[model samples]
Target: MSGERRRVMILAYFYPPLAGGGVHRVLSFTRHLPAHGWDCTVVCAGPDDSWIRDPSLLDRVPAGTEVLRVGGGSGLALLQRLRGARTSATRSSTTIGWLRRAVDWFAFPDSYAGWAARARAVAARRLARGDISVLLSSSPPDSSHLAARSLARRFGLPWVADFRDPWVGLHFRTPPTPWHRARHRAAERAVVAEAAVVLAASHTHERELQALRGRDGRPLARSVVWLPNGYEPANAAASADAESPPRSRDGGAPTASTESRFLLVFTGTLALMDSTFTALEALARFVRARPAARSQLQMVLAGPYESSYAQRVAALGLADLVRLTGSLAHDQARALQRKADVLLLWKPLGVGYRTMVPGKLYEYLDAGRPILALLPSDDEAARMVLDAGGTVVPPGDAAAVERALEAAFGSWLQGGRVPERRPAWLTGHARERLAAELAGTLETIVKGRR
Candidate 1:
């Protein structure tokens, strides 16, 4: 079998060109997994202009790799249409909210459910092309798992299910009904049970997936790997100077004020699995009590944001202190991640959020920059940050966040921008190593079956 072609068919709904953890995870695997013995082929939903696209990432795909675009991506299009003309429509207030719910009721598994049959067909064709020894599916659009499950059952191919996020208590959106929620739970349980190997993004997620049993009450996947999100050592994380620095919507030289200005950078979405209210309030308090500090403050919300974020900033009287750069290209965002006095992060305050860690945390650690994070103290993410010598304040505790902010600001004022404390062990989170680990897991799985 080793003499036969060693290949993996990956059902990734959003691969390269689509910017996200799912894209980064699979892309890194495809790039480095080959050295560890598995070549790759990816099946993605053709194209949807609605989601953020970074054409830059397409360049990172390995020369001999194959990316197959399957269905016409009606999932995001339908999502855009159902939300009406308002791009900012919330789930509760959308004019077609009921219609959306009605549509979602039939959206068993996930929004990309429509792509399953098409994806299955494409996967069948690829499997027939020869010697694809293993099947892997990455999800958030959990529909990919559904497609892989079908192919696995039909062909008796050993499949690996990678859950970038939890399915049942998913962070993406609220499940429409109890039945829908139950359906997701059942689907997750089934995925864990059937996968030849299951990969969880973190230890907490590994526990969550393993906690579920099969439909017949059997234990889940024979193997589970704690494959946390990681950073690429070769990612060329050099900070690119912005074109004269990002400015506020109202317009002003961001660096003009103060004897000593400090930049707090956050380079990902505020809308998912995180909130900024605690961080925001802490900054507001830090500035109000020391009006002179306002002159030195600048925080960049450097990704997609809502209208209300600006309103909130204005309401807190720190509009001048905050800059929203909207969405940036992947390289641009990575540059921003490195060009900061201190990296700021917020995990949404709740028991649910503790089970997940943001993908950016490792990238931050890899950058060797100091971080000011607002997350639960006992969760896996906090422990990782603490290990790498970054600050973590308990979520929703504005006072604690403010204290951390002030401490970081003091470090910036003192001249080191916080003592460089990133540990040597963080190199373990490098994508190349993780890919090797994944390759070993896949090899073991293939051998066990023999």
Candidate 2:
């Protein structure tokens, strides 16, 4: 081990095979980290997280990256373990679900409490090796940050806490309760305070942290840094399709002729926060208002929406108009984007959303299709789209959205030029850039400790 690269033990509970936006970020960082003069040892959750699974993303991890896995239980399994229930049936029973949440309310700040014992034990052992230069923690389960705090306190290792999403602020979902909300906020303050540096994925989140105070009454400042998520140019270029002509979705002759049907598309999981259902309403209203525009315009939603939400679409009498294709494979999804006339993004309502910029936004920029965003006027998503030369509409204003759709359709139908894909802002080298920035922060923390 003479004159070798410094080591970083990454504690992220949501790693690959348990796919999502957060995992992608962590995986990309670890995969490209060696080039930045650091070798990584990733300690993350096992494969039991069944919500979103993709083996394709795993290929991004470098060939020899040392991965340490712990049996982090699934949402269901965590509840069962917490409740001390033996069987799935009992765990899912109505009474037990309430009880589990009630208990969770009082215990730890996040679900990562489930993996605390395993991560604490492994992290302490790994950091004691003297060769470990920095302990880095990324959170979604948010448990990873807490684990880093524990190991730093116990082993005297310098640590950096990476907030891919702020723990108590701007989460896509609603808070558990007043108590849980307070606990999460307080715990996040403690976790951030213990870190040598705190890295946030966006500037909006950095501001949110600046608004809060630490237990010792010192306002969190300078230690916080903003690292915006970007599109990886190398990955996009590697996956580029050179020969495919820009064709309409219905399979007509390749058109250099600009006139084509105005097809709007939303491409990701269609959860409660996403606006697929609301967008459908706007489309239906547009069709009702402009009978002649029926053949000229359409909306293709490509992802998994809850069954009840699907039923809502059907019940609203939009069965024939809105086409719902269940979750598409990643390649297929990108292909659909290339064929699209307009990219549609929806921002959820309320303050929690005012700060978040979704991962899909980066990919949308890479897609280069004209974007029609329905977001709050002050929302981060809208701001990013506006910065990238895309159109924005007010949230819940179905009529305004319908009007925007008509204008975009008119342009395409009346022989206006189609937009070109944006230059890749997210490149493989950008990951190297981000890694370098993070590595510098680690060095500062480690040196200060000595």
Candidate 3:
């Protein structure tokens, strides 16, 4: 282990071929870790119906990196299958409601818990060879960390638990029942206590993790690191260069024309927590004030969205101006972002949101288009937007959003110029650079174990 390159077993339930923003961080790590004297073997869940699968993502994984795909029983898949059949007999029933609750209460942490036992068995065999240096587990399905904790304890390996999102204090998810809450809280504490280091995706998350204590009321882990999400510079640059259209004379907004409508693009899942409805309301207000601009404006939601969003657009009479493009591959989404006149981000209003930076934010910044972010003025995402030369308006304020859109529209009409992002700012957020920093942290933990 001393002379040979360090080997890390990365347990990420969400990995390549899974079409979502969550895969990028781990993908980048596996791509760049070898350059920094580390090699990665990824253990991830096999394809499931729960998410859109993007086989193209597998091409991005570095050559020589071993990826072990383990199949597991997905609670989400089962629930979706149950809900898929809505017979007339069952349409007005309370049974489906009760079953939904049961699934929520039992799926501790996430549906991927079934993957943990399989992953542990795979990890155990890998560790027995005495070649692996450390265990790294990233999560949203916090189950990955749970498995890593068990493996580390059994194998006496230093474990690094990475939290891409909060487990117990998640903002967007429904509050679990009291029993489920206690279970999540206890499980989170156990993982944190066992890991040698914990990596949080945001500063606020770091502070929250640092404050966590075990059941005995003692601090869980001695070290917690802040590792925010970032953009892959090479991919971003290439996509923008190859796919983006020429900017309008006024600004980086795409050239305005009858065919080239003022496009506002939003990528990713449009969940209840997203500010889609708010954006729609603002668009409605904008169109009402300037009815002539209706034909000129267009909003493209370029990822999976709830069916309710389509109904909302129709209800608000915005179907003419809005296009709901169901889930696209990661590369296609980025291409759409690069081609956009304005990129849209909606951070829901909440104190917890201050610590949450959507993974898309970095990509938005990298896209180098004018960003119209509906977020609190003091939120972490807002700060990043401002620093990257994007515009920010408070979340849930339709008037403010309307004003920002008007300003962007006016700038486009006036032949205004897009501001150049600070080179220093952009450099700091490159995925390779962040991965190097992560490598250094992993090195320290490995050395300390000696």
Candidate 4:
């Protein structure tokens, strides 16, 4: 290219105005890459009502950044609607099962396979114009990597495939049949073999990718890098002021002393698979054992939860102690985190849970409050919290949680002053620094081509 600054075309299906934790990583990359002499152009899905839409996130995008919005309908939402219709029909169970299997087989990596064509076409047009110097694709709807692989091969460009979540070995989904599993493995191998570099969100994920071998029995990718998620300092600074006092829905300051009650806050999606039930049980146990403690403690769940979860909390007779604030915007959630006396982090109970770390961990640390993490001792999240001077208890250990709560409550009662010691490791994971590291890696790839 003629310009001194190299360009990277990012293919991400999840981008802002779609509100979720998944968009932050790519958004940060786009925001900071320019400072490191790497410009970015993002191609992502267009607005869809079926998904949670947060127009406020658009403000976070860097000015003058070119974004290509592709509209081909949301394949994932369409599949869910079809499944609902099939369930309502009088079709045989076997037939419905077969149809679901067919969809899974055809979709390959994810239901958003349909978006691959449009994304590739947009990237190809830019590449043909001598615009994009390198290709970077991030995924969960792994179809983005498939598109990147095809375009890279066609245009002879160096590609970096980033896996935010494991494709085949994901613990949340039911295991596929032998044939489907083999096909998924083959596709993963192909992407790894073709890409110049592979990026995994965790060290464990990097090790897994490094273990994959090509058809010639050689290591799959030329290099595999661990590109973990991080926190944005600006967002942290904006919400840090919330630590002053709790606010009402109308943004009114606390009428009573904020220290009158020990506030524990959890912010994120609440699902059956997560440790929500375990945390609630622990709270109930603690309250029931010492009824007076309930008067001085309150736990707020600042996210959407199933109706059954509320019912369960009521059944436990701890409804008065727990508040479920449906769903809040990203900034609002951070504000809540900042106001809390203790932030709660829970890892879902399942196989491979130890290898994964939730994106919220960084935000929790950035909040500068004490964290009570309910996760396995061996998990990466647990290690980070411990390193950052936070508390940790094994998942499902109500007794341990109760003890921790009791101690935290006692500390709150006596002055409520928790020392703020930002861990040294946190500086290494800052969004700007990580983006600079990535920029250097991309520069290395671009220079090699020259």
Candidate 5:
């Protein structure tokens, strides 16, 4: 269908080895884009940092893709290294709190502020070779876009800016000073104005980005894209050495022992689980109302969790009911999801909250497990859950959270499996399908430049 593949450069700070929601979204593209007649050259942070690493993800990277790792920056990454080997508690440690405060005080664009200069220097050489036609930058550190913006200005190449989350409207903040707010807004507006095209991961985000205006009072960018996150079902099974699907010691489906209990599993970074403490109260209440149910119910958190979560679990007398598995490799995490009777997703309502959807929501749907989501009913994340036949309860509604817990457990106790409902439209959320959408967008951008 094509003669030669088009080459494009991608800048993503949270790529493979650095496990999280954003990593998979970028990884999926790299793996599937080559088939779409595109060559992906990714620039990401080195694996030597103290951040959570999922080495298995490297194997999933297509052999044809080029991944260049660069190191620099005094961000939270540097701060984490100072804590020695307490990597398991990386999320719960004091580093996160310090990082948040630091953002308000000094790290202008973001904590990886210092990393931008070095990244630009590296990317500058790659672009000078004349093989790259277009550029794409994905963000959370926001510094990636800053670097891409600079490179675009200097090289005169069109750049595509991807927002996994908003810059000025980011969730969870203590309200910055008027000066900092203006600076953030100005930076965000500049990016929107300069990017050739902007891709937003949330529907609400696309609408917000499209509303931004330039200094001349015009629409910010040429176009704003709504490209939501998706899940990849093939990566785990592609490698012979990868984690096999959830199985007990006998190499069969989850053991009868696991089926005998109501196992609720959650896998991902637990930093933003705002209503979990209140939800813990519900769990305690569940156990108290039916003391016998305590032995029948258990929740396993299969990713990095803050020490605060452990403390809260202990205080609410749920230490026995809740188990934290620190961190699991990417394939292992998906396998864990397959074994769960119910998956947990929680997001508390806040300003800009509806605009932020965690990447794991798609993975939860792909896992075909009933998701118990504690979210605002109006949020897009809540809609995804309901569409996929999952249950959603309003955050901070203890009575509703308890009811969800009670009902899920009741179903499990009756030797029933909540239907693993896969809607006809869910196939659209596959990684390959999403990559096709991206290929279409990238093709349009590249052709327009010619």
Candidate 6:
């Protein structure tokens, strides 16, 4: 109503300073879309309320980018539901977490149930202005898409559903029960059917979304597109001052000259499903086989680790070999990646880990460090590393890991380095390119409306 630019509502559960997989995808697009003929209004939950957020990441956004933080509302009202749940000595914290995990797996649409009410409220208010050209929702917290689906019907606005990861896919670890899986799939069908355009972060995701829509007996619209995740190259290249206490890594200068003795780095939350334990086991075995590797290797686990798991790690007697560096600022993690000799990637053996491509792989590529990919056999991360001209060791195979470590050490001693060929596919321009693709999809949607 006020300007020439088409107004778009970006409903993302994760936004800047919320340094997670969804953060970069949503943040970068909203940051750069002005040039592509769209003005964005990001609607997301408050960072303070999120499990993780990176306010600093917002520095890259255009000066006047409008961000609206809605409450984690009735969707998250389960805290009240579980508040009076039983507490017992038999129910240890680990058991409790698993219980929550079980509840999460079986709970259809409940994972993001907390944010639904507030997201709907915000979208309703924003779209009521009648100037919102498109309603875009990013999923997993698929609840946001549900909000957008509801808003689209209410406001008669064309909707764009952005799938950073597919809601129903090979990557999802759904409930074993058929009913639960069906409920989840039904929700996915509903959201996809209602969207004017459906976007996926990878070709794999796009294919899966197509299949899901096909399974639902919906129209085969040309609105689906693969918009792979990307890094902010200029921001990646920018240097951090030495005087500032390195915000993310081991609390030292990010551009430190001397190599950290035995320092292996991993960033991101150490989930129960992550292969951190297996990697630690491998590192322990590597040191046992090669004493020099032990003397030189300082394995650094970055990100938040579950306390119970940390105790398990201590029990493994890796207190000396493993340096538990707590969570760092997003930029700090990048700085640490810059200094790391071997960036570590770990994927769990079962369920969700195999099909998922960790977004951090792009960051690792941008870091230009040789990756020590400890992934499931034939997992996405392994493929990326191999494609990127890096090395990989199978997850949970301590013997194979030992062999890989020996070869890595021997190669390093012989000056073996990860090849300098930047995979033509990997680049920061993806966000801009993706925005253009989405714009075209929107154009198709706009045309169909006429």
lDDT (CA) per prediction: 0.74, 0.68, 0.76, 0.76, 0.78, 0.67
Q: Give the TM-score of candidate 2.
A: 0.83
Winner by TM-score: 5
Measured with C-alpha atoms, the lDDT of residue 229 in candidate 4 is 89
Q: Report the C-alpha lDDT of model 6 over 245-323, residue by residue, as the tens digit.
A: 3332234443222263635778776655456777777777777767766666666676655556566568877777676
Q: Candidate 1 lDDT, tens digit per residue, 131-155?
A: 8888999977788898899898988
Which digits, one per residue and each the tens of the lDDT, describe model 5 over residues 1-450?
246788779998877777777788899889998888889999888775545677777878898888888875347667666664344424644657776787667777777777777778888988888888789999877888989999999998889999988883334454468777777777887888889899999999999888877668888778998988877763435343234433331234532244567888888877757677767888888889999988787777777777788888888888777876665677777777876899998864577677888888887887789999888888888998898888988888788988998888887777677766666776787889888888888888877888
Candidate 1: list runs displaced more than 4 Å.
Answer: 1-4, 74-76, 82-106, 168-176, 214-218, 234-260
Clashes of 5: 2
Q: Which ten-residue region of model 5 has the weakest summed lDDT?
A: 247-256
- lDDT of candidate 3 over 1-450, digit per residue (tens): 245698899999778777676788999999998998999999987765244556678889998798888875356555655667321101212444454456566776766677777888987887888888889999877888889998988988899998887773344355467776677667877887778989999988899888987668877777999988988753645554335443321234543332357778898776554478888999999999999998887888866655567777899999888876665667767877876778999855566566778999888877788898988887777888887778888778889889999999888767744553543577787889999989999999988877
List runs of model 3 lying over 4 Å from the truth: 1-3, 82-102, 168-174, 213-219, 234-259, 416-423
Candidate scoring better on lDDT of 4 and 6:
4
Is 3 or 5 the stronger prediction by TM-score?
5
Write down the RMSD of candidate 5 (Cα, Å): 3.4
Q: What stretches of model 4 exceed 4 Å from their correct place?
A: 1-3, 79-106, 168-172, 215-217, 234-259
Give stretches of model 2 more than 4 Å off.
1-4, 76-107, 128-130, 169-178, 215-217, 234-261, 292-298, 421-429
Candidates, ranked, TM-score: 5, 1, 3, 4, 6, 2
Among all windows of 10 consecutive residues in model 6, the one with the lowest summed lDDT is 84-93
Stretches of model 5 off by over 4 angstroms after superposition: 83-86, 168-175, 215-217, 234-257
Per-residue lDDT value at 388 in model 1: 77
Worst 10 residues of 2 by lDDT: 86-95
